[model samples]
Target chain A: MLEVRDIHTYYGDSYILQGVSLRVEAGQVVALLGRNGAGKTTTINSIVGLVPPRRGEIVFKGETITRAPPHHIARLGMGLVPQGRRLFPNLTVEENITLAARTGNGSARWTLDAVYALFPRLKERAHNRASQLSGGEQQMVAIARALMTNPDLLLLDEPSEGLAPLLVREIGRVLADLKAQGLSFLLVEQNLHMATAVADWVYVMNKGQIVFEGTPQELLGNEEIKHRYLGV
Target chain B: METLIIQLLNGLVFSMLLFTMAAGLSLIFGQMDVINLAHGSFYLLGGYIGLTMVRRLGSFWLALVVAPLVVGALGLALEYFFLRRLYGRHRHLDQVLFTFGLALIAADLIRWNWGAYVESVPPPELLSGQIPVFTVQFPVYRLSLIAVGVTLALGLGLLLERTRIGAIIRAGVADAEMVSALGIDIHKVFAGVFALGVALAALAGVLGAPVLNLYPGLDFEILILTLVVVVVGGLGTLRGAFFGSLLIGMADTFGKAFLPEFALFLIFAVMAVVLLLRPSGLFGLEGT
Candidate 1:
């Protein structure tokens, strides 16, 4: 449901993403796997117009949205659980979620009640400021905040980056549940196990370019590809 | 005993006025990280505009309402045309330089129009006399100013604490990028906030003009006081501004009243103590 084609992004004068391209179909979890400095986050940011691509196009549900502002892109049913879970440190858990609430596509599936049901710990700590929460709890709040937008395409950048194993597993379960609900996702992950477990398709990126694309089973079976590119 | 009581009332009145001017300055700095050297220009603009309105209509209340709107529009224009382009550039010095230039320009404009002479506005009829309290008589207008300042403070506190827009503003202050990503048009938010802050300063100026007097150089005087307030209150805390104003206000008032020769030293002395103790102001958050 989302297409990013030959996008170039820059941070100051340094070109971070060099003609990177990817696609995610409806009701699919597509993994963009890469090592450090692979431009995965840059690709995601370019799509959301956080770091607008200087070249190429981004299309979402048949509309070219390359030049749209970040808020406008967000309003167009794309949610980003940004790396580091950049929650408002002073806002309460509930405020963080409700602040992003929008009926972008007239879908009410991801309301406050729905989010609370997904993370009951958030409901219990709804009144506590985001900084008061543990890292895992903060991640949950960040996810729930993005979900409140009821986005058509959710971009998750390193959701499991700093979480414990148990929290990572819980995050995996949440992604599985979200996949069952027919939400498309472009997940940028460093954890191969979690990516393989949740993602239907995989694209390995190296040196600002996508080098491999296949079904998760195909990539798992290709030992040479994993050893050379992913070191797994 | 009468002199002490009169000085006590004077301290309260001055503290309240300081609160009015400092609160908006604190919010703008805290939320946008904009130093806004032009803030005092808005205050000066308010007094000049209010002077004109009061002269034409002979009504303090009318000037109070009209002056802020004019100064606020000016602030909105400044944000849209100038300050919006400087975001996230570590352009703090550039912002200071630009706004300091703007302050100088504003002062020049006021001078060109009103000249350098100090002009005074008399209190309205109801507030023209003094009210006796215990053996001291206080100017009814000063007491009225204290009442208005307190009311505005409470109203602002409620607006920040209880309203959804206030919640968004507070959130924006903490992480503006996150707020923008959450479907908020931060450009619009920033403009509106800057305008609101300017309007508050204007309102304080109009309310205070009768006491402080109107002159072109008034901007520099109030600007220094505002810097002191912001520094002592920490950068972004509203509560800090309030308490800091009170501390400075009381110090300035009682020091001048009791020890006229050392009153200026008292203001700096209080700031020194605060710096030695907290370094971030009395209520400001550290590393903000």
Candidate 2:
């Protein structure tokens, strides 16, 4: 479980997230839906300690981790599939996965073998450099690399951003399978259909603030909310 | 035929030495994206420390073994106290200014301690004499230098290609943020890498002092050569550094031997062609 309480984040005196707050329960997939420039990436970055929040607190499993460094936060069982699939271009697929292969919680739920099983294409191109892979394959490698750490909570920022339709559907299936395995997630997604299909709870963000919170059914029924905020 | 063979051997020796210096500089630049003007100062430091050891203990081998360790520790301290704060801030001008100042300071310190006079290291007695190779007499010391340089290069390559830490370093060069996010403390990695780079430069200096001669101004000359190597080999690729060094060394050696008046111009010409054609050096990765 993760709790971000009234956090304010900034980028060199320009305010990005003003008193933003959200939470995700254990074994739940919570969607943070927002349009462009809604501070979604900033929020995710703050939680991961890549961009430390200037004010308020971020707690994970009852411990305040606001001031922790990015590596320390990662070591605390949080895996981040960062936006834009920031894979090591020169490294092989296998090397990329193994680099982050840490059982932070001392559990071997997602080992290299398990990740290979999840994405067999990764095994096929395990020796190929990441730059040689297609966009979808690169995304899979990024996800598998994060999962190799066996994180308690996975943060996926736009997993379907640049994928084809089939790949997007496949990503949704992978999320569903991971959800079945009782792994918690904070997914920042732009695709409403994919988010609704996979997420149990939804939080819509606009202008660095959360404006709506409800179940998938409630969100689907609220046409006015979707149009006004998400522009769906 | 004998003249050609001698020149080729000389080229190989010079290439190996250049590789020893440039490889570390290239890796550090690639991984941290820092233009370390202070790199050659470490090289000078190594030579000075080795000279001291040789003087005190009268042992060439002891100086060779100990000087790099001392210079490497110094490098670690420098990175921790100074270069660590300048990461990810687009402060390259600041980096160059700070490192240039550091280089000047290091040179001044050396000059203050050793005086401004140039010093020469005598080769070990066992390696002092000449040996006939293919009917041409070549100094045993030059041969030893070639052997040591080649051995170090091969050893370093193995350590990089076949180790976990090397993989992490290579990955860090490609994307440092991703490496940091993977739960490896990048600051510690950066410090270790900076020290490692400086150590390589130091080792090259100690090994090379017998042939190159050591003085306060030695840093500037070697720094220019290292820059050429970095540019020709591509910015961040170790293999690029090796190839670039070989090209430069061959050009410098052969040009000086056969065409003395045109050698310097020829070196820059090679660099210009490489830049115009590939711009990334022969072995460097594209777009990085």
Candidate 3:
């Protein structure tokens, strides 16, 4: 479980996440929905300590990782599939995954074989350079790269941003399967359908604040909140 | 015809020497985005230290082993104390200016301690003689440099491409923040790379001493030559550095041998042509 309390983040003088807060229970798929420039990615960056929040605290499982460095935060059992997939273009698919592989807390549940089984397409192109992969394949590589760390929680930032509809559904199915395997994750998304489909609970963000928080059914029924905040 | 062959071999020797120096510059530039003008200072410092070791200990081999280690420790200290303060994409100009200042200081220190006299190390006794090649006698040491350069290129290439550390370094070069978020301490990687880059330069210094010699402004000369190689090869890739060094080294050697008056312009001419054809250098990626 993770708890973010009144976190304020900034990029120089321009305030990004203005006292935003959210949470994810263990083994739950929590979706944070927001429109363009709604501080979704900034929130993720804050939690990962890439841009540490200037205010408030982030409690991951039990440790306070508010001002820790990015790598230290990661070692404290967090994995990030950063926005844009950020794969080392020159590295092979296998190298990209294996580079991030760490044996943390002695729970090596996610190995190369396990992730390959989850996304068999990656195995077929294991030795190919990451730059040569398709968008969907790159996304899979990114996800696989995160899983290789065997972290307690995964933070996914806009995993379906540029994928085709069919591939988006495939990602949704993968998320569902990951959730079934008891993987806790906080997914940032603009895709309402995919978020609502896999997420156990949902938080809608707008202008750097959490504007709505409720069950998926509660969110689906609220047309005004959906239309105004998410622009759906 | 024999003169041409000798000059060609001479070009090969200089190319290998340039590769040894440029590879470090390229790695530092590629991995940390730090344009360390002090790189040349490290080379000069290494050479001066090697000169002292060879004079006092009477062993070129001992100096070869010690100079790099000493310079590498200095590099580690430089990264920790000074260079660490000037990191980030926007602070590149600051890093460059800071390193230039460091180079000036290093040059002065070397002058004060070692004096301004030109000094050269003798080749090891085993490699002291000459071998006949195509009716021309070549220094065995010079010929051995070609072997040394090739071995270093292969060793460095293997260490970077085949090992996990190499994969991490390549990843860091591509996207350091993403690498850290994956549980890697990128700062440690940065420090290690900075040390390694300068150490390689020091190794080149010791290796190149017998031929190039040590003097007051050789640091700047070596620095300029290295910058040309990195620019010609492209930044961030070892292959680029290797090929670029060869191109620039051969051009410089042949130019000096054939058209001595235009020797300085020839290397630049090669660089200009390469840039016109591929703006990113021979092995550099686009937008690097």
The candidates' DockQ values read 0.71, 0.83, 0.93
- Winning candidate number (TM-score): 3
lDDT of 3 by residue, B1-288 (tens): 998999999999999989988999999998999998998999989888989999999999999889999999989998999888888989988998999999999999999999999887898898999999878999999999999999999999999999999999999989998999999999899999999999988988888899999997999999999999999999989999999999999999999999999999999999999999999999998777
Q: Output the worst ten-in-a-row residue range by lDDT, candidate 1 chain B.
A: B279-288
Best by DockQ: 3
- C-alpha lDDT score of every prediction, in listed order: 0.87, 0.89, 0.93
> Model 1, residue B228: what's the lDDT?
89
Model 1: per-residue lDDT, tens digit, B1-288?
A: 888888888888888878878887888887788888888889989988898988889998888898889988988999999999887747898889989999999899889998999899887776899988788888899999889878887898888767778888888888887787778888888898899989988988888888889887888878778778878988777788888888888898999998999998999999999989988888877666
lDDT winner between 1 and 2, please give it.
2
Candidate 3 TM-score on chain B = 0.98
Between 1 and 2, whose TM-score is larger?
A: 2
Off by over 4 Å in 1: B259-261
Off by over 4 Å in 2: none
**Error in Å for residue B87 of model 2:** 1.6
Question: Candidate 3 on A8-47: residue-level lDDT in tens?
Answer: 9999999999898888999998999989999999999999
Worst 10 residues of 2 chain A by lDDT: A100-109
